[model samples]
Target: MTSQVRGGQLARLLGQWHALPGRRRSPDYAALAAAVRGLLADGRLPLGVRLPAERELAEALRISRTTVTAAYRALRESGHLTSRRGAGSWTMLPGGHRVASSGLWTPQDDLDMIDLGIAALAAPPELVPATRAATEDLPRYLGSAGYHPTGIIELREAIARSYAERGLPTSPEQIMVTNGTQHALDLVLRLALAPAGSVLVESPTYPNALAALAARRARIATHGLALDAGWDADLLLASIRQSRPRLAYLIPDFQNPTGHLMPVDLRERVVGAAHAAGTDLVVDESFVDLPLDGTPVPPPTATFDRHSRVITIGGMSKPYWGGLRIGWVRASAPQVQRLAAARIGVDMSSPVLDQLVAVHLLADAATIVAARRTQLAHQRDALLAALAERLPQWRVTVPRGGVTLWAELDGPVSSALARAAEEVGVRLAPGPRFGLDGTLERFLRLPFTLPAADLVDAVHRIAAVRYDLDRAGRPQWREPSVIA
Candidate 1:
């Protein structure tokens, strides 16, 4: 790239973080370095791109040359950048290897059959009007470039306000809107945590989270979160205290598959332990709005996190619609800037139309949440009843919120069991799909994403298949509920 292009890109990048706002005071070295590293993460600065001279950057910003010097030195030490006297600075993506993405999102061979595979709910009704308004307002910003690396202020502010309502006081600068919870989590993993860093995770966490972490080659440490009853605080606290990892990932509120909420005290304890060990915590709160039974639990991990070290990821996919593809992270302003920079390589920015659609959910979240809770509660009850009547041999847990159920079977072969069920036309998530060691072999996950009639049919099919297996001398089993 030409010097002019590089210079302009660098300035725009810095401006995204408000670090280099053109001809003003010099940027903070630490913040500038963070932004620069993010640029490298997204391939904005390719491998071995010659960085601008420290003196030139300083002169452009009209600040002390030492600031740019320190920023370059910081990048070099972090291994994100390197320098030679004649060659100047060179940008490099953090670490060397690019871990291949895990290919795991496949559905069955049906020409549009019942998809019990994806744990997604139908789109909420409230999305209609919220979407209409965002589309109406899009023309107002259409006149400008509309790059929106920082996301629309209205959505950022809305997300932060939502966090504040949950007892985690936040500001717009601390948030970076992404395509979905997966996008936010992926960006945070790329920017804050280095590749191959030890990633502490609950046994059977959301599967996609596992894929995202694996893509970075993060060493996975699985702590078993009991699906039979709920989260094992002892396991979580001990893991955080002893692991001392670079990152501790959790789905505390209505954990995936298992649908267990870590009690408020336990949430605080885990946060405290992570903080004490100086490990960054990534809390996936995608189910924040979907407490199906009883009053929702008050367990916002970020509220206990003072430094925004606990990056809370939430999205519209869980509560609203998967197609909307909106999720965000609640972090400090500096961290938000870092995420925005890191995201560019993977995607220039999340689609504006989707962002606007999400604004619909944010605008009237309460009504949408209430309707979801009621609908999910009904579905949960229906599934439970169906399982009890048909799959009596299998043990199941009733979750308070969210989409899926984790259950243990009479024998130790959920994978084999799932294969058997598939023979009869029902595709179930095998227990081994959740656990890395295949320990949860006696378990199965049932998602309530389908309608009540379909779920009932699925349970009936599962029970009939189980009976056949039992009669044939095969002991059926399942794994723990989560999949990380």
Candidate 2:
């Protein structure tokens, strides 16, 4: 269905639109056109939704109406917009630039379906034994009221000790157990960000993190990441200085989707910059334990923190299993108290049984994670090999660790490929899902969480889908079902 975006709303969504990233001054009409095009490409601006009239937008942005008209005209020429004499102009993607309507993908239940949309692994072999141990240890708390808002002492100590082992000295008073990384992030957002506050994030980051920011209606500032040049400390510092965001969310360890690990020196530089800018950094360490290669992984981002400005989020979902539902936040004791107090209005506490299970799992994490790395290495190799043999035209960066490969297709047909893969019962997430403003259409994320055989099969199915798309000159573009 077609809908209209009011001038005020569009103006807010395009915060600092005149100051394009990496530019020295305000943009002209052509630059304005490119920014709107970026919004349309990254799925932030919906296709087929009517935009505010040129005069209305000009007044809202406090610019001249002629500039808006020229920008609209440029958009029309680029095929990103359509206009009628009486109907007005609406957004649209140019030919061969189709993308998924939604960035979120739900799991499918078909027996034969090969689901790669979610980058998660099955439970490790040690889970059952750990759960049994937890059950045995549950009786000690049977007589209690079963309410520990700050989490039980046992799990908190285990998490804190784990941090200490990684060169960051932490105490149980500084840890607050939570449901998962997403839940922890939500709690941090609630505590750190005011409504409409600015936030800085890496472009092509975790999709759910984007959802969290969107939920709060936060103004997002982005720093782009690429396989060729990983994290640019100077560029990141510039973004921090320019945007002056209230909070910054990053996935430095085997960063989601891209799987590029931040160097130790880079981490220190980034932490120092954020501290200087007074921007609280929320570092996600969910994928820290799944290093498939032998390279030395850097210590947690909080290790470089001298002023307690960094909050580290860690969880068992990625390494052990997603079903555990056990995650924790490491911050200063006072910060932990603040978060725990705020969490009362949310979930009072995590499940006792799950927390108990986590206690046992953390005890043997080293052994279990070693086995997991071996398994993941095999699967990662299998996936790379299959793609090398079948889809050699596509470019893929080899990640030292992490479970996913960021694949770049020869053309901007990621959304079309995902749609076609559904026909063969192979679910895939397009590259735009990991990006902001409907960008990264030429990329796709392929996880190696499945078994070696299943990874091979998925690659075979994807190869077939690409072959069909190539044969047909790409699928016909379909209008998105919903626009918001």
Candidate 3:
């Protein structure tokens, strides 16, 4: 059965479609078709999902019925949309196969591909030593079953002590280990949110978090962030009061995509709002340890948790290494128990050897993170300089921390550009992947985890692709103004 999207919902998804960037005149039907094609190509619009009627969409967008008709006709001609006499129009890929709904431009094991889709770094030099130490410690537990559901004691205590160092007193019993922060988030959503529950999230949040929510079939309400100003506590407070979602997944520490850190004062207010609304604040601190600018990091959000509902999730992926696959949740002891019980149905527990390795790594986290920060800073500077030299019209805020940059493009052609870049062996994560519906077409996420030289080369290739796209008069071209 095809899932149907209503006209109003489609309108919300196609935000400001007619008011396209750099286009002085009203958008023609070609622009509309291109935007829809972009959405399909990027996987924001899933295949087999029924689209709204042309007249209905035209009414919702306040455009002529003829414009919508022409756009649909173009889509059908291109094999992007299919319609039947009795059945309405539905989305489809050109070859009628499923594409990854993650909306990432992925390279299929292409060695030449420069991947900027994921924001993870290579393992630090300390990992080998840590693994060696962990192997020595592993035999001590060989006598018993290696299943440690709530994580091995050593790792749990180390994680708790790390939180204590950050001014939040956490006990080992309050921590529950999982595969990673993503797994931890899934566990929390399963335990905290009921079926069809509502979740409040930032407009451009971590894409995987949105995926998790969608998998759980949760209703999402978003709070938009101003790229220049960052988060507005007042606006968030209003949203909490109005929507009263069951959970608010926040990434305040160098917030994902945007890279905006929440000030201490705003942190307090955000916690208060969630508390007032009785919302479980799932605060993701995965990127907390990567402050490249030496900005004074604020205390953990758990510091302001008046209620026991603030579930603080931390991981070694961003700071240490993604392959570690170790993460933990810091909540009240009872909450930890509940999460652990629920986790048994999934993967019984994380790998015992990995947990042992995590213990060794956490003991030396500060030194490792400091060196990692220096390397990231260098790469980030390289990427920024390259973007400035090649694509200065695309606006990018200088992020103090985090692995990725949220860049506003020169026009609303991010998806089109991403597809074009693939021809030159550069993979991209278009802006719409991080947003709800088909929104954020005017933005893109660029990660700086690659080597400095590689990052610069990737940017150069992307710039060349954009130039070609512009010159070819592709569907992404903005129509110029006309004087009668």
Candidate 4:
């Protein structure tokens, strides 16, 4: 059973509930109860997760105790919640059903859900031919024991060569392939951080990376990256000096969600600061190759690491295809060896076929990058245009690269808006999902990975829900946070 949620967690969840639509026609208590039921139906509030006390939730939401009591009573009557004299209310599916935690995007059996949660692109046209070509070479590995813990030597050399061309001299010995960047990040965190060790991460960073670090019980220290200003080198330097974290993880190039790239000079300074503070840097270059603009790609962070303090993680998932599931860590040879050894307990090696396909794809990197740049640029523009025409209240920045747009909603009801959008067949990742605690309620990440027509239609659905919320006389809650 999931542990009981209380205080801030429950407050955050309830805040999302309060943002639902149809409040104009329904009683406050009934509206609140229906919001809670919607969350339960969508698996956002998992079955068996205990809720906050009625009074506590009321205070958090700044609503009356009677209102919350009535809402809880309604939920209990509907069989969506259960309460006892002492035990706080617990969420339940109707008929005592249970649902598993499916993270942020749970696919509904319904065919029309437009997924804007995952920031990834489908396989490029090159993937099919590349995989077929890889088959001819597969026979060579068939005679071997078939388990190469680090990676097959050929693929490693190709990756190293790619790095060298980008101004970072890397040996094949410096590379260790993993299932994806997430796995590579996990291995590095395990190798570098002790339990409860401090880790400096970018505020509004990739949610999955935050989840992985939390799982390791690391104490996360944050430095916010302004969408306009990008990384504040001095602030980041100060954070590293003050916190003295064991590691610092950053996505300097076309950062996830925000799409801000750290300048080359800032990159050098950050590496130097981390080195002086004795913190290793884990830089994610997953979106580095997906630049929509024609600017030359920034060199790898390792290029600035005079002390070998940077562990660079790159993957084929974002630029080429997520299904390939091929990623690598470019670190010191010793660190690479350590990570490979640590992988012994996990799956011994990535699939040979996937690695082979990745090698073929990497060989065609320039063409693949160009194709993605053109495609994403078109989709990004379409999304921006749609949002401007349909939801003028939303403020969105034009990302230089990457697949997602970090959009600021007009109010602090992203969770509520997402829930409302779901009823209209649109899936969204609310802002709070990206941040620790209950912050970022006013933000949402919108991906342009879908076709232009679907992108337009998704925006229309979201606008419809926003219209409903507006009609319900929901107070427009605004925040001062601004992103360029």
Candidate 5:
């Protein structure tokens, strides 16, 4: 039996539909078709989800039935939807494959598909040696029960020492190990937020963090981050003072997608403002160690916490390797204990082997940081040059750190471009996926974590798809503009 999505549910899921900005030259039906195809391509409309009937959806959306029928017909011709007699159309991938809705890439995924969706890095060269050393030390723990709810003591102390060295003065009792930064954020949100409680986050922040907050059913308040100016401190402070949310999440160092670092003074002010408003601050430092420009990084946001109101989440995922799956949350001793207790229902503890590997890797933190900095600098430069050569119309900033570049297109067609790019074998994370509302459709986050050759080839493939879109007079493409 097929699962049916009702007219109301489908409309709500689609959110506010806007035509591609700057593409008024295209027909409305074609634009609507592209939007629906984007939803399927990004796994937002899961495979086999029966769409609402054309007439029903058109009435719900207040659009003409002819427009809806034309859009549905286009989708069917493009192989993104299938319809049976007396039945509604259903979503499907090209070639009649039913893709899982998780949107995660597995080892079994199509090997030829170039993935720019995930900003994860591969294992650093030091990981193998570290893993071997961890295996040698594993025998001592074989005699004891391996359930370390607060993480193995050695790993906790190592993480705490890392913070202290960075000027945070953390103690082992104040740290709890987690599977990853995402897991750490989930645990903190579970402990700090209640149903219908208010939360504050930066607009265009990490998508997974937003997902975690949504799962808790918390009301979210957003403060916008300007692409060129970095964080709008005055607006953020005002929001905190006015809303007084239960928690505020900020990525102060080398922020995801945007790659802009929050200045030290602004960081202090934000922390102070949150505390004055009686709000707990959750600072995500996952990208803190990946500075590509050799700038001196600022102290962790916890440095300004005079009232123990700041909780910092860190991980080895970006700087070290995604496969390590080791991260930690640093807070007050009492708060750490509460979080560890709350996390028991979710996950008893992170893997001991991974924690041991993290301990070894942390021992040589400086060396690893130096190596990553050098490698990423080269890749970042290569990607910038490639984009300039191929897609000069797209504006991008050279981020001082972080793995991705947030490129702004001249038109609001990121979702459509991503869908089309997939047909040409490149998968991109559309900018709207990173935002709460259906904004940022003009932006695209491209990771520079791949090798220089792969980065170059990916851009070439993307440019080819973009050219095709332009040739078809698709609204997503625009004439190249002179770079100021």
Candidate 6:
């Protein structure tokens, strides 16, 4: 018989539970087996709880029942389960896998898993043609000793024109090419941030950015954008005033994991806020082109950067492909020189070939954007529709642009849900991985960059995994798993 957890019975047992960790010859056996034991020790699963039948789990896994029996036998021998004849295997854990009811995003099989972690669509077919065209012009630049630190004028001019079309008045003198968006951002940070100086960023913001600042030991102050609706102006201004940070980083168009787009008015206020606070503003528009809506997108944050303080970091990765490795910073002429110097030790220059590909793609951006806009819209819609129909227990808000659907799962099992999805062929990133500390443990960021068919299959697999966990008494499954 099952019994509810009462008193410190759980906390006390939880403190004493122990599960040995070891690598298994079987990838599937390793993570799950260890997890089962760990969960028992942690008191996440009370004694006498029914374990999902071995046959059912094995069927879902496409594995033999013998293997499942072996796994269960091992757990039982280790004091995890009390398997009596016909009584079925029941959780009688004091020691076992450190599986928690809330870990949906742990490792499953290192093989047979398709990772949908960062939101990036495969490159468009046209990218190859652009690379060839850029290669043809490479020979001419080679005559100049290939030491152009200010970067090839062709790519710089192209990026400047892109800004101009985006409603930002820009000139070639205001652009600098870098290895990628991160590189450009790092260079800008190197130039702008002082040791212990503060930076204003969104809580649950990009962790890489946090790591970058941490590398410099810079103090970061954050404002909340949890509404998933984008930036909150009043709180943002307060952060600006209170922290008086040296730099402010924003993804205003579709802020990373939160998927919130900072409205036009908020953008204006933030720019003014930074200017008044004597702060430098840096905006990343990496996924600006990936909205599900097929239409022209907005310009970079530099549109209101009259003081030349805002540095806009952009890349061809999202629009073109992740392998492109091409990004640039739009800043004043003086700032461009500053970045060139900062990057001398990093890499004398980005590969001449890669820059060529970016140049050619920049030439045909309009057509490329149109095709990408259509494809992403379809993929995103299909994923959202599937989630709505199959996993209504979750909440997912439709993003205007950007490749992810930031959904909040009902329970605290986002991490658990991720772990379960792995066993079922769907690899996912835990919400916490995208946030600072444990800020978003209940949220899930789903990527819709795959083709419509794959997105459909992925959502379906995710649903089946969720259903199995619920049936197995892992009912901490987020209710309304698609919480918007």
Candidate 5: what lDDT? 0.82
- Between prediction 1 and prediction 5, the one with superior TM-score is 5
Query: Which of 2 and 4 is ahead in lDDT?
Result: 2
Error of 2 at 143 (Å): 1.6
TM-scores vs. true structure, each candidate: 0.74, 0.80, 0.85, 0.86, 0.86, 0.75
User: How much is the lDDT of residue 38 in candidate 3?
Assistant: 63
In candidate 6, what are the lDDT values of residues 23-59, reduced to their tens digit? 3333444445555654543234445776767776566
lDDT per residue (tens digit) for residues 1-484 in model 5: 7678777766765664554433476576787776676566554565688999988988888889998899889888877789997967898656524332124222234557778888877788888999999999899898988899889999999888888888989889999999999999999998989887899998788988988987787899988888887788788899999999999999989898799999889989988898899999999999998887678799888898889989999898999998788888999999999998899889889888889999999999999878888988998899999999999999998899999899998777777677667666677888877786557878999998888888999999988877776555442311122333
Instruction: Evaluate residue 163 in candidate 6 and report its C-alpha lDDT on the 0 to 100 scale.
Output: 79
Writing each residue's lDDT as its tens digit, candidate 3 over 430-452 gives: 88888887678799999999999
Itemize residue pairs with steric clashes in candidate 4. none
Of candidate 3, the 10-residue stretch with the lowest lDDT total is 475-484
Cα miss at 333, model 1 (Å)? 0.7
Model 2 TM-score is 0.80
RMSD of each: 18.7, 8.3, 6.0, 6.0, 6.0, 12.2
Give me the displacement of residue 156 in model 5, in angstroms: 0.9
Model 4 per-residue lDDT tens digits across residues 287-311: 8878776866777888988888999
Model 3 ranges off by over 4 Å: 1-37, 47-109, 474-484
- Stretches of model 1 off by over 4 angstroms after superposition: 1-112, 470-484
Error of 3 at 470 (Å): 2.9
Q: Tell me the spans in candidate 5 whose CA falls farther than 4 Å from its real position.
A: 1-34, 43-56, 63-109, 473-484
Please give the lDDT score at residue 439 for candidate 2.
Answer: 70
* Span of ten consecutive residues with least summed lDDT in model 2: 474-483
* Per-residue lDDT value at 363 in model 6: 85
Model 2 segments more than 4 A misplaced: 1-109, 473-484
Top candidate when judged by lDDT against the true structure:
3
